[model samples]
Target chain A: MEQILANGVYLGAQYAMIALGLTLIFALMNVLNFAHGQMYVLGGFVTYTFYGQLGFPFVAGLVMSCVTLFILGALIERFLFAPVIRRSSRDESTMLLAAGLAFFFDAVILLLFGEKQRGVPKIVNGVFNWDFRLIMPYDRILICVLAILSIVSFILFMQYSKTGRALRALAQDRTAAQLMGVNVDRYSMIGFALGAMLAGLVGGLLVTITGVNLGMGGPTSIKAFMMVMIGGAGVISGAIAGGIILGFLEAIGLAVLSQYGDITYLMIFVSLMIFLAIRPQGLMGKPWG
Target chain B: MKRRVVLKSAVAAVALSAFAAGGAWAENPVLKIGFVGVTSGPAAAWGISNQRSMETRAAWINETGGYTIGDTTYDIEIVSFDDQKDPKRAIAGMEKMAQEGIHYVVGPNVDDGAAAVRPVAEANGIMYFPYAFPKELYTAPASNAVLGMVANYQSGPAIYKYLMENKGVKTVAFIAANESDPLSQRDGGVAAAKELGLEVVSDNVTYQVDTTDFTPVLTPVLRTRPDLLVLSGVSPANAPQLIRSARELGYQGLISTETAQDAQVLQEGAGDLANGFISVGGASTPELASDAMREFVKRYTDMFGEYNDESNTKVYALEYILETLKANPAAIDDVNAFQATMDGFEAPNPYMVGDAKLRYVGSTSFGQKRQVAVPLVVNVYQDGAFETLFVAEVD
Candidate 1:
């Protein structure tokens, strides 16, 4: 039970970090940001180059990932999203653009990084075993703590900072925020960049453990969607709750269903479907089109 | 009168140039071979290795005045398609090869891709050597796909017997990626292990191919305390993570797989934790590698900026195709003729030093000469390289 809990907590922390960025972008831009996962992959490669290849300190590599993704996000929002959203009439048009961007990022990543599985040296070593009941690696524990810290930092920033206040108002009501002199274009760009930075931060952190590849982008986005759906799309608290819930369910399912074999994931998916059928709005989401 | 003289002089010039070259032909013809497989996604290494090996050998042969069969010396050209690991795309790739009028091809590296392209290969009279291991692909009523490497069943029993006799292994466990290819391999490994009189303590453990953290998936298998853990049909990308997870879980038993792995990947992904890991490797070891094999590796490295160990096995498919065509030039355009030639086909293996021979086997396993008879070279991962564990033959 202890081992399962530890696994759940660790998995939840990382999953929540991944969902946070996707949810943030959706809330700010009202665009699904399908390339969010590719942005995450770009972050991982940046860190892989800086830390794994260039012998930089791990912290520096992580910071570099954030800075790089942040700039990229701002540029993408200004050049790609803003122009398309302006000219397009239908919401699905943005979805198409987002999907196209996903393919573009996938191609760019494959060209730049190649298809080899890459990893970094463990930042810390040794196992954290408590009588074989609650076993965890120190690297995992450090990453979990760091992810939680980053999440808290993000919440504080959104709650207190002037830019964060402006972004929240924009997300709440774009026209009202614009009338209030929030600089809609600039604040929207900042919010998108912030969201992308979170993705980069998680990607940079998890690259040490899971490592990243071009193929991971699609699945990561899908998993992030599951979390958002479970918690409620475009809701930050919903994303975190959804992440933790899915994480615990996977941990428990794997632990209990070992005797039954590969059907654990199938059973989990079925249960989720049943839950969604009963409550389509998810745990905390309001009805939306 | 002037036009007639010009034409006469042009004909004489052609004849004189051909006669001067001491040949009856103007220039050599080109034989195009096709490669269809994943060379872009996560599993890119597998097909990339296959494509690179073919390209390297083709370059070498072309550089050395082309390959002569019967009355003609022909240039080797590789036509490749990146299926991106999708079966539907693999079918399209096969169709493209047929459209190009290629008779012999290599690849579609995974099980589904191989299986998917079979009908196209048969209908189009194209012979494809695939790196997949489903027995039905080589059995009766199916003839186009030739097994490119040693199957898990063959390597599994061999490893199990060696361990049971030498390392005292009694109980074993199996884990796979929950995909069709790996699951099929797990079943084969399970059967092979059982036939060898070893107990399969656990065999149902599986994880998604995209799984990053394997602790949850491996914990129950570890609890069973099997002496041997077989990762069935594992890809190069996922092998090290599984090994690292098992070791970090304090598994003191032996870990093995039945697929070629990249040493650099293992080193990067698992570091020292990958030491003592066992796997089926490319058919040649350092001791077994001929000078030609060494040169091929050097050229492959030079051409691609790096070399993949899997290419050691991949290098043989195109050679087999060309040599078989040379044996009976009729097979160049007729695949049925190629199938007829297989039962009695024999050639000297160029990759090895000694009296190693290249031919088709699988009469015992599949009741046909539908498998490549490459020497099975078992490898154990050490610091940053795969040291030879043992070498065996498939009969």
Candidate 2:
């Protein structure tokens, strides 16, 4: 039972880190950036290039990955999403466009990186002894710390920063916020960029824990999407709640039922379905669509 | 009337010259050989190495004035394609090669890729010289044209029996990737255990392809308290994880895997946990101190700069194929007849594990050899490196 909890907590931190960016983007833009997962994978590859190939420091690689993706997000918003939003397409079309972009980026990644699973050098290599019997990797503890710091920093930004206020306003009512002299377009671009940066941060963290490959992004994106739906899409607190709950469920369920059969993925889906059917507004009373 | 005569004469002249060129080209009769494997993706290293080895052998054959059949010497050309480890791509690659008029082909190095190419090779009457473990391709609803140069999965059972009888391992457990192409072959080890009257305590299957976390699977097996654990997988990455996780969960027993990749990398990853692990493969370690083996290793390392896990086996096998062709060139014109000659030919190839002699079984479906006595070496991780425990011939 302790082992399951330890595994769950480790996995949960990674999941929350990944979903944090998605939640930020949806909260501000009311646009689900389906290409988020591809961006995460791109960040991982960039880290690999910086750290593995160029022999840069691990921390520098993480920062470089975040900054690079931030710029990419800004460019994408200006060139792609900006025009689409201006044209006023149906929501379905918008969703399809985002999904198409996700696939396009995935293929591009495959072409660029090939399909090799690249391992990252460990940043902190030692097991943490937790009183008597429990032991875990110190690196996993670092991940949890990073997640908490990120969530706190995000909360602080929203509460105090002027730009953050403008983002919140836009999320609440884009038209009213535009009337109130907020630069909606610029803020939306910034929001997307921030979201992408967060995702990149998560990607770097992930490589330290799990090796990165081309196929990792899709399943990760689905998990993040599930987190978003369960936590309430636009609610930041809900994202954290959803991530932790899902992580715990996965850990506990795998511990109990793994011997019987491979029911880990099935259990996750069943939980999501039950949650959606029972509470249409999600955990936070925030409607997803 | 004069102009019309001129035009008719010109047309006749063109037709006559075209026919003459066609006849000249037709008299040459070019035979094409196709090579297919995962030339890209994570597992591409294996495929690329196999292709290079095949090319090297082909170049050597062609350099020696080509393969002579009867009174004629026809040059051998290898037509190669990248399967990328996808089944659909494997089929497409086979069809494309077939369409390009290749009658003989080599590879589909791994099992899944071989499975994909098998039906296509059979349909086109193309001889597929697969690099997968022997039994995988030959044991099924057999195709005479498909030949495998590697040792069979039954090799595992042979190794296990030797270990149990000699090394005193009494209890065994089988753990394999659920989706691995050779997952069924784990049964070979299981059956061998049963035959030897060694306790077969558990059979556990983990998810295939990308298994990052093996803890959930290993925990149960450790609880069962088997004296020895056998892992069936290709890479060191998976093997180390299983070994490390097993150790973390407080299980101390002998651990063994099939490939040298696991033996080397698992030690690096798991440190002491990888100690005492033994595995079997087609190639002997370079440290064996045999003159022929030493020379082979030296040439390989000199050419490629490092000893690749399976490259020696593949490269030498290709050389064996060329040597066979040289000895019996007449067999080239008629594949079936050539196969017969290969069956009858018996010269020990030092490239195989045990200075093993190769002979073709009369059964065409079974390829060139029904069995080759590749020597299996038992290695233990000692003082941070793999040390040979025992070397024995596994027939």
Top-scoring candidate (TM-score): 1
> How is the predicted docking of candidate 1 categorized under the CAPRI scheme?
acceptable
Instruction: Give each candidate's interface RMSD in Å.
Output: 1.4, 4.0
Report, for every candidate in turn, its global Cα lDDT versus the true structure: 0.89, 0.68
DockQ for model 2 equals 0.19
Q: What is the DockQ of each candidate?
A: 0.48, 0.19
Report iRMS (Å) of candidate 1: 1.4
C-alpha TM-scores of all predictions: 0.93, 0.75
lDDT of 2 by residue, A79-185 (tens): 88878878976666557777888878766776666444555556776667565245566766787788778778887897789988998898888899999999999
For model 2, residues B1-395, the per-residue Cα lDDT tens digits are 99999999999999999999878545444446677887653365566567766665555556566666556665666778988777788889999987986656777876777777878877876667665654646653555334444343544665577677777878988777654444655666677678879898887544444545565566666667888888865454466666666765667777876654433344334556667767554356655435655655555555455444455445554454545555677545345554556656776665544546654442433433433334455566654566666666533
Candidate 2, residue B163: lDDT:
70
Show the lowest summed lDDT stretch of 10 residues, model 1 chain A.
Answer: A280-289
Candidate 2 i-RMS: 4.0
Q: Score candidate 1 by lDDT.
A: 0.89
**Deviation of model 1 at B378, angstroms:** 0.6
| Error at B177, model 2, angstroms | 2.7
